[model samples]
Target: MIKVAFFDAKSYDEVSFNKTNADYGFDIRYYQEHLNLKTVPLAKGADVVCIFVNAECNAAVIDELIKNGVKLIALRCAGFNNVDLKAAKGRIKVVRVPAYSPHAVAEYAVSLMLALNRKIFRAVNRTREGNFALKGLMGFDMYGKTAGIVGMGRIAKELIKILHGFGMKVLAYDLYPDMEFAKQYDVQMVSLDELYAESDIISLHCPLTPETTFLINAQSIAKMKPGVMIINTGRGKLINTEELIEGLRTKRVGSAGLDVYEEEKNYFYEDRSDKIIDDDVLARLLMMPNVVLTSHQAFFTVEAMHNIALTTLESIKEFGEGKPLTNEVVEQ
Candidate 1:
């Protein structure tokens, strides 16, 4: 029986992985704490360590895991931005569930847009308080609107399809553009400048790399259409929170839908309602009515969770069998 250490373990994570492990039967120990220098000792005596988005898989943690004889790091999420791939390159194998359900995130992005557009949460509260007044709930039709999508990944492709059904014209920017997919989906492959200048809604679906950090800064916001809606289901570092707050304060950007925050690892997965949040940037975002903030839950659908558990367990089984890692993330 292979020993597995699971970090950042939530109830949902335990439920899914335990159910899936009935087949593979790997001994998985769940830890509520994150994978960091302090918690790395918990992984000792384990064959592999399973982590999620919030786990800190820095070089230090990687070194400790290697010292502990842990050979594999399995991430049950698509984004590996938190993982130090360079350090793990030669020492340990790193794998992730790249595409559990693109539809889950894409649809959640749409939900955020709808929530911001219609002021659904505010309305629900108003009705419950017997204050059903229809004064500030005006929303423009998505028909004939242009949506600019950054990073034409799987989630972006799914988002484009949904936007098209709403009679939206899609403009996309990608470092490696798929011309065939664009042509097939009636999307225009445009430059970042053009996408920013003309779009009513700007959606980010890019990864967090050195090149993409703070991609939505004040300079880029200045180029966008006034009152432009910004939706980010991508990594939190993709947008600068301070600049975004300024944009919202001045009404330069109309609304925002954020599922990820740069400093989310400290507070996202856990219940922090009882504690006073010390993150001022996040608190500012919470106060804004135009911003619909979610705790990185864009990929929390039951379907996606099941797939993630099954795929992660499968990868672990394959490694134990000494087979080729189909979903291994090789450092570029």
Candidate 2:
């Protein structure tokens, strides 16, 4: 039987993973704490180790895993930024659920955009206190508006379909152009500069890489249309939080709907409301009336979770059976 050690297995995580692996014929061990160099011994005879986002898979952790006879690293989420790819280049194989449910993330991005644009969060809070005045609840219609989408991936393409249904024009920018999909969806591929300058609402769905880190900075914001609404359901650090705050303060950015933040690992996936928020940037972001932030829940839907678990377990099974992993990540 193949032995699998799942690190960072919270209550929900175990429930979902077990539900999917009921008949997979694998001996699975769950650990509540995150996997690291010190905890690498937990994987002592296991063939595979499963991890999630926020877990530190640095060089030290990778070295320890290799010493413990671990062969594969299966990531339940799409982003593998936490892993040290350099260390795992030739030693162990790394696999991830690259595309789970694009609709879940795309819908959440749209929900954030709608909530921020219509001031829904503020309005709900006021009404709960029995203040039903419409003094500051003004919002624009989505019809005929132009939306800019960064990185035309699966989620971005799904968002384009929804935006098109709402009578909004879609402008997209991607490193590799999919001209066939663009023509089918009636989306116009444009330069990044044009996308920033002409879009009323800008959404980010790109991955996190060295080139994409802090892609939206002070200079980029300066090039954007005044009062442009920004939405990010992609990886955090894509937008420079300090510069974003400056944009919000100056009203250069009319509003923002963010599902991720640069310093989210400290606060997200846990409740910090009982204590004072230690991060000033996160605190300031919360104080903005036009800003709406969620705890990286763009891919938290039931369907996405199930798909992620199934795909991850299937990859583990394939590795154990000496079959080639269909979702393997290789270094160039």
Per-model TM-score on C-alpha atoms: 0.99, 0.97
lDDT of 2 by residue, 1-332 (tens): 88999988878888888899996968899987688877889999989999988788999999999989999999999889999989999899999999999999999999998998888988999999999999989999999999999999999999999999999999999999789999998899999999999999999988899999999999999999999999999988999999999999999999999999998978788867789998999999998888998899999988998999999999998898889989998765
Write out the backbone clash pairs for model 2: none
lDDT accuracy of residue 279 in candidate 2: 92
Off by over 4 Å in 2: none
Task: Kindly report which residue pairs in candidate 1 clash with one another.
Answer: none
Give per-model CA RMSD.
0.8, 1.1
Candidate 1 per-residue C-alpha lDDT over 37-104 given as tens digits, one digit per residue, 9 for 90 to 100:
99999999999999988898999999999999999999999989889999999899999999999999
C-alpha lDDT (0 to 100) for residue 106 of candidate 1: 98
Q: Model 2 shows how many backbone clashes?
A: 0
lDDT of each: 0.94, 0.92
